[model samples]
Target: MKINIQNYESYCLLYIDNELSAAERREFELFMQENSALVNEFNALQQTVLTPETLLFEDKAILYRYDEMEASLPSSFKQSLYREEAKVVDGYFTRTRIIGIASIAAILLLLLGYQFYFSNSINVKNDKENRQTNNKSLKLKSSKDSNNLVRVDANNNLENNTLTKHKSEIAKANGSKLFTSNNLPSLKETDIISQEIKTQDIIIENDVVTNTISSEVTNNLVSDKNAISINNNNSPILNNTNIPSETTENYNTINTDEHDRSIYIANFEIDGDKLRGVTRRINALFKRNKNDKQK
Candidate 1:
């Protein structure tokens, strides 16, 4: 069994007081004899406990003076101490508040900077997209203009062919030798068409002859060549003296007398009384239809 060194002092004190039994005293003496160092330490401890140094009492009042001196301390001294402590605490709190505010400001600044950077990047991206779109639009417009030019050239060729056919038909109808190889010099189709169009414009500007001559010529030219016809419903119709009898019969057969009558009536001048009569007849017809529906 291992003996605890902490209990050695207690064993020695018990042995000196003769409180241990013979078996315990014999075991303690055997333990001390085996540990010679513990025996010397125990003897010194026993001497110190049994004969301690004498304590002098020259200043016995010093022990009881501490409480009274503390009680007699001035209130101002305590207030000053408390004030100093409070100042230290207040400084610590102020420094903490300053740090917190600085951190918050820095965070806010970072957020604002990020937002500005994001907005700028977005605007730049939008600008790039806009530029790309504008470039595409320009390319499309250029392509469209080229296509239009090709279409215009094709249309001009078709118009020249139609004009040549018109010129031949007009020459035959008028029984004139206008396009004869000997009489007129050979001209380009464009030049001939342009000259004809100019002549027609001049004739149109002359109001006195336009209603009679221009309408007949334009109608004959359009009908014979199957060209685009003038849609002027108000144009006056003249007697087709130069037109072939077969052509005249075809025109008359295709259009009914009722159609001619309607055209003539549309062109005819009407008085206010006739217009009022027409309105009254229309109102009576509407009223009759409404009554029939109800029945």
Candidate 2:
């Protein structure tokens, strides 16, 4: 570490003048052992400052004496002597001006270098901050977009589920209306219902019709047959004919003629109480003779 001799000027001067107290002189000697270069520079500066030799003088004798002293000292020590002389002259405005314009030019160059270094550092720091900010903004936008996409998907799924439930509820209401009472559907209403229920994904429209007719006919037949054979077979009978067997396969066959097409079923389920639902042509056709007769 380079100590600033400027702060210890009095101690350095006392040492130079051989006026230090005995204890202070001992401390100074120990300090010199630790910092020879500093002691040598201080000693040289003190000698130059104490001497009456005017640095700006052009006298040949003065110049010759300076040259002789410079030759006797080591190169490093001579440089330090010149440096000390320059420091003293630098403080005096008149002496600085007298030293020529080149010194002023050198100081200006050092100041410009310092200013340029600081400016470039600030620019680099600003550029880094801008890049970081841009990256963070992009990340935030991406996260927001992802969240929006997720919400949109969830909403679409919810809408589809709601539509399905509504269709089911309509089917149930229609089935209950058909099984419990007599209400004839108009031709126009039938056509509209058929159009609404028919899906191109199903094999054929006629298949759906056939399945409905088959379910109704089978239920009626079983009911009528039971009445006829009830006394002959006294075994307790359960009315399970309303539910279609799983052995019934879905038909993929189709016919171009609208009158000769096969029937297909879309859904069939039994509730906890065994109130069977037979969804054939987007509507439930229940096992009620009065409603069938009306239709």
In terms of TM-score, the best-performing candidate is 1
Estimate the TM-score of every prediction: 0.21, 0.17
Tell me the deviation in Å of residue 9 in model 1: 82
Residues 192-294, model 1: lDDT tens digits: 3454444433232322222334435433423333332222232121121122221222112212223222211223433435444554665565567568769
lDDT of each: 0.45, 0.39
TM-score computed on alpha carbons, candidate 1? 0.21
Model 2 error, position 95 (Å): 13
Pairs clashing within candidate 1: none
For residues 89-187, write the lDDT of model 2, one tens digit per residue: 344556334443544464465456545644655665555434333332232222222212111112223333343233234334434221111122222
Q: Which ten contiguous residues of candidate 2 have the minimum total lDDT?
A: 144-153
How does residue 210 of candidate 1 score in lDDT? 23
